[model samples]
Every structure is written in structure tokens, then in C-alpha cells.
Target: MKNENRRTFVKKAGIGIVASLSLSDIPAVMTGSVPDRPEKQEVFFTTGFKAAEVTTDSVILWTRLCGQEKPNPVVHRRREAIFRHPIDFDEEMPVGSMDGGVKGIGGSVKVQLSGGGQILESEWHSADTENDFTVRIPFDRLKPATSYRVTWTAKLPGSDALHTAAGTFRTAPQFSSPDAVRLVTSTCQYFWSYDHDERGFRIYDSMRRLNPDFFVHTGDYVYYDKPGPLGTTIEKARHQWHAMDGWPSLVDFYKGVPVYMTKDDHDLLRDDVHPFSPAYGQLTFGDGLKLWRENAPIAGKPYRTFRWGRHLQIWLMEGREYRSSNQDKDSASKTIWGEEQKKWLLETVAGSDATFRLLFSPTPVVGPDRDRKTDNHANKAFETEGNWLREYLSAQENMFVVNGDRHWQYVSVDKKTGLTEFGSGPVSDAHAQGWDQEDVRPEHKFLRVKGGFLEIAVVPSDRSAAVIKFIHRDVDGNPVHEEAFSSS
Candidate 1:
């Protein structure tokens, strides 16, 4: 892949320009560069692939197979048997280490979860053939909040095209406590630019340094459908997942951090394709969503809640998928969070006994401008949750909202309520555009469209009161903004 452009971007775009970083600055030590390698030989059916879309209790592992085109045009096919072997964290074996398993490749491939031993193997989907010849296995029912070792194998029909890939992931903790939860929050990755840069790597390394209990990728992991010609894919009208593979820097960074990822518009396919756009903003293909499922470490349930001891419980909502009415925005009934998710979030919040409740979103609930309101595709979790806060829990102060999408970082506290919102933009990929400070209400606390991450400390007190302090900083660890407050 051509990386000179990325190399140049990094050298020039330092400090906060998230998209400016180039691929050259990464240390050879960090990247583990290939030493004088020849062109890759073609391996059809199971040669091209990497593990992705990880979650706590479950994972949607995927891979691309190269073989005969779909609709084989023949009946009475000779199918091969395929099987998976799962091991506990104590098993330090590789995918190749496992022995005794079946295999086969039919354009698309997969296996579901059942009792401990591998048993759920169904006919693969035909539609999965066209895009990179990939298939997904949504492995649910695994132990929650625990680590697992997975091994996948596919044996070609009448040929030794045995294909396999191995990886590890920890299920979102099933149990929560004040002290066991460690979530690392960050956003705006701009993968391709980091295909060669180290800035993104540096931040991820720091996150690993903190050794967060779990990693939370707030949003914009990959800018879907980048506006220019350099990005967008014609066949799909959006962007492609292979773009992620090209980003060596990002892949390298994630290799170290066990990331639980979600997206704004970027990971979905494009920047912002609303109801008014041409052809429903390029229509999100199952293949694209499938790719995301393959890569990120998250639970399969689009929106689920996890308890972090008695001190905290986080309810992750699928804010974007069903935010608006299934129709274009013209309908009077259109909304950000559909009635179902909204109801669930409200009920979950009202019933929770945790000391702190957090709604982790991809976009800001209260922005100074009209960015999300216009994008039909933008998630409505924030707006919907904000409304719930106003109508249902007027004085609720234990809940905290955090989001990352814009290429900046800031904190704001509502005067009428103790609710505070912390916004962190492109972790390393700073953007040129910024939030209009003047547009914000006079009560807004801090706003800066700079690239950085937020460090939050929740300290418990004897009198049912808790102290929370947040410090926002740039990639180099310079504090740009800070705040502290007490909540009861």
C-alpha cells in the first residue's frame, strides 16, 4: 500500500490534527515491520482474513473465503465438515495448536454457540459471497466477563486448503463491582491515516499503560465514506473494510488494547447519510456491518447493560440504528431514539441502584451547533436520553454522559441540573472543524475542539456523596481542561 502520503500527514499534523498524521513516524520497533518481503502469494478460499467484532459474553468472529462464485450452478455438492475448538485463558495454545476438528469452505462459513463443545453448524448464507467472501459467527452463551481462546478451521473440498485464524477476547464482565471495572474511553481513530503513523499507537499504548478494566472506543474508529475520492467505494457508495487492514498503525495499536468498539457515522459506512440523502445515504450493507462485528470487542446485543460492582452500572445503547422513524425525516413521528430503546433506557435507569449510571454514546447529547440534527444517520441516544432525564428523572444527578465524534475535547455542566457531559474528540486525529463556542448556552462550562482523551476519577465518600474529577489532555499528555464536582 502507498504510505508516503500518510507519512507526510503525520510529520505536519502534530498536536491535535487527527487526520493529519502520516504513516512514516512509527518506530520500526513499534510496527514490527516486515523485513524485505516478496509480494504475497494468492491464497483463495481462506487465505485473507483477521479476527474482529469482539464482545464480553459473545463475539462475531469472521473471515473471507476465496473460491468458486456463488450459486454454484450445480446440485449434489460435496460439502466438507468444519468445527471450532474453544479453550480457556489458561490454554496458551495457538489456533494451529488445537487438534481434532472438522472443516469446509462454501463461499460463506460459520458456527453458533451451544453447550461447551462445538455443535451449532448451519448452512452458510449465500449473500455473504460477494463482499470479500466473508462470514460471521455470533458466539453468544459464552461465560460473561471472562477471557476465552478461539480457534477456527475450514477444510477445502477434495483439497488441502485447510484455512484457520486464531484470536482471544474477554467477555464483558458478567459481574460488576466498584473496583473491578476498567474501561478506557477514546474516539476518532482515522484508521488509514494511521496505516503508518504512531500518534494513534501512542495513545492506545497509554491506554494499555493505564490497563483499563475494559476499552471503550467512543466513536469514529474509521471515518466511513470519507468525503473525497481517495476514500469512497463506488460499488457500495460508502467506504470499504479493507481500508482498515491498510491501516497498520491502527491495527498495531489495537493489537495491544482489548478494545470494545462502537461507532458514529465512520464505522457504519459514511460520514452522515440522513433520510434526505440519495438512496437512503448509500444503504448500510450487511457486509459492512458484518465487518465491524468481526473487528471490535463488544457484546452481540446491540445495546446492553453491565454492572461495575455497586458503585457503577453502564447501559450501552444502540443509539444510531433505530433513532429515527424507519422512513425519511418528513414524518412527524420521526425521533432520535425509537420508542423501544428509549423505554428500555428509561426503565433501566430508573430501576438501577448503582451509585453512578453512564450513557456511553458516540455523539454529544448537547452540542453548540446543528450537526447531528441534520444527519438522519446520526444516533439519537443523547437527545432521547436528555429528554428522558428532563421528563422522568428531573433531579437525577448520579448519571454521567460521555461521547466522542468531533475532533475535540470539552466538558460542560448544566446549570439547572448537576448532569455533566464530557466530550472527547478524535483521540489523535484532530479535525480542522470545531464547535462554535458562541453558539453554546451561557452556562456551558468548557468547550475545545482539540484532540485528546479524558481521565475520570470517581471517589466514594462516607456520607452517600461521591467526588468525580475529569482531566482532559492531548496526545502528549498536556492538560487542556479539568473539572471536579461532588454528587449525592
Candidate 2:
């Protein structure tokens, strides 16, 4: 058994719908109304284990340990190391256990235990005292598309026996050029209504039917609604998230999609909230940063890229959050993709051989966020002005940009090169907003502010060209827009 004293593993961090025309185009509200969801009664952490961060070969597993309480609220405040683990498993394994044996498998601090092929050595580390009792383990050397069982235990101070739970997980398929792959991309799905069932969700349900390879969440997954009786300050925004239960309905939708997400203003704090937002220069930065990390799977580096087969490579950027000064409109020093991220993005794209290079920017990589009614830095610099990416786009013919934030969707073509930019937004907000719909230059191909997820079906062909069809849908699962683009 591992040392029960050194159990706290401290670090942390952390949808859509459709619609269409005709009978199916009718909104969910007007359709044969679905019954309201049942009220959530007691949530006593009845669920013991959860897992995430699944890769082709490895996954990060996590679970919680509870303390004594009719409700166990004390466990939520103290971050301590009162955890344990077994070295073996029995036939009747519980739902959330990782360790195998009942007692110390060997020594108190020095022991070897095996489960999923690799042996885990007991490393005494302090666990967080004030939070959910949890531990993260890297299941290494796991085979692709195979399932494995794991268990864990946490021995309370002075207790001889250990508390345990067990669960199983399967790794993603191997990555030697998949025979087939598809992706769905969109953003701005704010969630607070606990209904779990909604018109917005029907879109996600439909997308799942297509069974995409992997989904990309451009940003604005959670909207911290504000401007209430509470004071209008940055701290207020930070507190708003904790008050709103942090993660929203969008989070639940992604749980089933194996999604990759970036952050937008809503997820950060409010509409147009930036690093220099009133509270950012103060102490609220740490709290805000901590909360964002705790609730989302934002890349530590913020902007990163991933490749799929030889046809597509995705580059995602953190448009906001990290910045020194925003008032200096022309200051190149005022960063968007922070220095490191910018270099990595350029180098990755420059060296990539994929047929289509996709960049997922939270805000529009082309126009102003009309919803915010301001010249959002993301649009002005990253798209219109001479930013690093604006230049990079000119040199690559097969590259395209996808974004979310303005609560609208548009397919714009570069007047000069005929390059297209697609954008989606506010996947679940109450009302649809209008973009400069009338300002459709010959360069503008499509734009709509309807609520829905962008359905991206990517078909790889043996004949060099890959066909990607972009289908737009609304709340009731109706397809409203369809356009196809291909690259060789």
C-alpha cells in the first residue's frame, strides 16, 4: 500500500443543436413539447470516479475520497493526504478503485505494484486539503483501443484499512493514419439551465449520430452572465462563475464528444472581458486563472496544433487571457498569441504537409464581434490588420480559419484570393443576434446568427483531394445551410 499520509495530489486544472426549414425546422419550443427535466435531488458525490485526457496510448485517471459526514462537506474544504491504494484486484471489483491489493502491497513508502502492464511505485506527495479528494494517475504503456481496469484507496489518518473504488477505461484507437476521420467544430454554447435536456442539445445528439472522429470546441463554452445587482467589477465576474456552478450545459455536451476546447471571453469572465479587465490588474487574476484551469481542458500553452492523417492539421489559438496592454492598439508588443505560442504556431504551420491546415480561433479571425459592439482585438489584429497569422494565411492556399464568439455564423471569402472563413457562435443563447448581414461584399459568401452547431463531415479520398462538407443546423435538428470545400 502507498503512504496514506502523502496522498494529496495537488495540481489541477481543467454542443449544439440544429434546425432547419419546414416541419423539422420548427423550434423545439413549438414542437411537440418535450417534458421538463426532473429536479436534481441530492448530489452526494454518489459518483466516486471520473476520467479524462484520453490519448492514443495513455489516459489520465482520477477519483475522489470522502470524509465522515452525513453529507461530507468537510472533505470539500480541507486538502489533506489521507489517501491509500491497493496493489491487487478481486473478481468483484467496485466501480472506482485503481489499486489492486487490500493492504500495503510491500513497504509503507517503498513498494512496487502492477496493474495495467506497467508498475506504479509509491511516491509520497502531499495532496490538496481544501477540495474534492482526488488523485490523477498516468496509465502508461496502455495498448490502443483496449480497455483496462484500475482501483485506488485512501486510508484515513490512524485507520488500518483503506477505502477503495474501481473503474475501467479504453484507450483511443492507434494513430497510423486512420482509415476514416470526421470533425465537428463550433463555439459559444453557454450553460446554466440544469434541464440537461434542451433544444440546443438536440443538435449535439444529432452530431453524435454521425460519430465524428474528434470534435473541436472553438470557445465561449460557458457564459458567466452578469450586470446584476452585484457591483460591476472584475471580482464580481470571478465570483459569478462559482455562483453559477462553474461548468454549464456545454460542458455536459462535450463529455460525450471527446472534445478539444479553447477559451473565449464568456468562458474567461464576460463579453469582451480581457486580461486588463478592471479586476485583472488586481488579485482577481489568480482566482480567475485558477478557476479557468480547474474547469476547462485549455492547453497549458493555450495555442497548440494537432495532426490527423496527412490531410488535416489543426492549430488552435488563445485569443484573449494573456496580454500586457490592450489600450495600445498598434503596439506589436501587446500580445495575442503570446511570444512562445506565436512562434510555435508559425513553425508548426510552416513545417506541416497536411492538405488542409485549420486554425480554431475563439473569436472571428476575420471580422469585428458585432455582438460586443466594439472592435475586438482578436478580429482587428488576428484577421484584418497585419498580424502574424494574417500574413501566414496569404502564403498557404489550403489553410482555412474557423471561429466562434459573435453569436453568428458566416462563410466569408477573401476578396483577393477567394479564401473562405467560416464562423459559428452562441450555440445556446436565448435569442439570435444579427451580424453585418447587409454588408455582404462579393467576398462574403454566407452569414447567419441562428442557434446551432456546425456539422463538419470530412471525407478523405484516395485521389489526393479531401472533401469537407459544412452543414449548419438549428435547435430542432434541422439542417439549414450546406456548403462543401475540398483540398488536394
The global C-alpha lDDT for each of the candidates, from Candidate 1 onward, is 0.50, 0.51
Give one digit per residue, the lDDT tens place, for model 1 in 10-111.
767754553455657655654678567554332233223333344445555554554422211111212122101112311223212212111113443443
Where is the poorest 10-residue window by lDDT in model 1?
77-86
- How much lDDT does candidate 2 score? 0.51
Cα error, candidate 2, residue 255 (Å) = 5.0
The prediction achieving the highest lDDT against the true structure is: 2
Per-model RMSD to reference:
18.5, 20.4
Expressed as tens digits, the lDDT of each residue in 1-488 for candidate 2 is 34553343221110023332465666678677767885422111122333345555655544333332121111112112111111232313321221110111111111223444755544532224332223444455666555555444555444456445444544555444433456777676533221132222444665666566667777765454422212134334333333222222332333344556687766665556667775532335445555565545433566767666656677878877665444455555756657777778778878887767778877665553443344343344333333555556856867777877766767776555445678764554343466555666565567666666677665777636677777777655567788887774
TM per model?
Answer: 0.62, 0.65
Instruction: Output the number of the TM-score-best candidate.
Output: 2
